[model samples]
Target: MVSSAAQTPSSSVEQARQEGALQTALALNRLLNPFKIEVKVLGSTAHLRGEVENEVERQLAERVALATRGIETVQNDLKVNAELIEQPLERRAYAQRLEDATLASIIRARLLWSTHTQAASIEVDSREGVVTLRGQVSSAEAKELAGVLASSTEGVYLVNNLISLSAADMARLREEHQELIADPPLSDAWINDKVQTSFLYSRNLDGPNIKVATQDGVVRLSGEVVSSEQKTIAVEVARQIRGVRGVDADMLKVATKVSG
Candidate 1:
């Protein structure tokens, strides 16, 4: 025997709770999160009000509301506006970040592979196509070479070379070089990575279009270049890498032009 007056307040509280739950569900949905949606609940029926990118999103919002624990029905009052949606800016930002990381890796590999800068310690950072080089090098020549290699990389727009000459670092590097000379030959994996990176750092070469594979101390190049000179440069770059016994470019070919 509950009084109607008492039942009114209890019913209102239940409606509010249901509305909150439904709104939370909509907000957490990937398709609906980007839109501003409003939810209202009356008894077991939930009403959605807002604009969505398309009919799919409208239906999705209604479906989400209906799936809530206390909602048995949905009143989808959402309007569709194709103009409400735009390309996600975060995706472009993520792509830029990935490019910067790859640029940094290529610069580091170039420094390590160069005979003049091989023993030098350097740090590379890239952002929006600008590269920054830091750490200590044995000579001004080494510092300048590091900058040149970074600036010459395909994706680099500018280089900030902050490498300083250090006598103590030079001594340490010389010792490390001697130890490296006593060690075994560079692994095939190392040679493969360096050769690919070198291509990226070298001008007039299409690094991404070229394929490189290493076995023992030999590198095999296979891919298309715009010209025969590019093909020759590809072979020379691979042969210059330390511990590379030979380069086989039999599969490398120059791209043929079609008449327009």
Candidate 2:
């Protein structure tokens, strides 16, 4: 048999490992991750201390802790406060920063994929939904198109276009354009993702209410929109995506308002 001293060290290590696993399980839960919840494990019992939005959430946290493997009992010491439902200011600010970064990336990809603006060297920056475009384009039309694309993207509240017209390298521009043309066709999955992203980013469309599917370069839209004009706009948006051979919006219907 192993000595008691040896067993003590091994047991301690196992307890620490179990503590870390319990903490991770709590953090991964969407409802509990935002709150500052503390977990401590001793033997087979887990201790939880934190503030949750309500009793339901408190129970949820306890259930999650108990469900963890090796955790047989949970000492739930979480307090219920309605105010805890509101996210902390730091969390909100962090989320905004992430949104701005994502918006900038999307606009840059849009410019790169557009045949008219792809050759132009454009820089995109976004802050709190406002986008700033800078760089040089070969012509006035290209510069204007870049600004329009940036403004139309979802989450963009405003656009500041500072692109200037300049004489571009003709040979390099030609080579880039030819490369785009020679590239292989986009896959069906790629087309579907882009189309869905376009709907989500469009300011005038109800993105969540719309469903998009693509097969063989043909896009099929099924969803409800408030007006006929919105339906038409949805079809046009899908058609404009790169590699989309056709858009079929026959199934997309206009929602009739109910009398109050």
| Best TM-score among the predictions, by candidate number | 2
For model 1, state the Cα shift of residue 66 in Å.
Answer: 36
Q: What would the per-residue lDDT of candidate 2 be over residues 112-157, giving only the tens digit for each residue?
A: 7655677777889999889999987766767887887888887789
Off by over 4 Å in 1: 1-102, 113-118, 139-141, 197-204, 208-216, 248-251, 255-260
C-alpha-based local distance difference test score of model 2: 0.81
| Whole-model lDDT values for every prediction | 0.82, 0.81
RMSD of 1: 14.6
Stretches off by above 4 angstroms in model 2 are 1-96, 113-115, 138-142, 169-174
Q: Provide the lowest-lDDT 10-residue window in model 1.
A: 87-96
Per-prediction TM-score: 0.52, 0.61
The TM-score obtained by model 1 is: 0.52
Best candidate, lDDT: 1
For residues 1-260, what per-residue lDDT tens digits would candidate 1 score against the true structure?
33335558878888889988988887656567777888888778887888888999999998898789888988889999998757534544565676678779878877879766788778899999888899998778778878877886777889999999777998888787787778889899989998997897787688989999999989999989999989987886787677789999999989999999
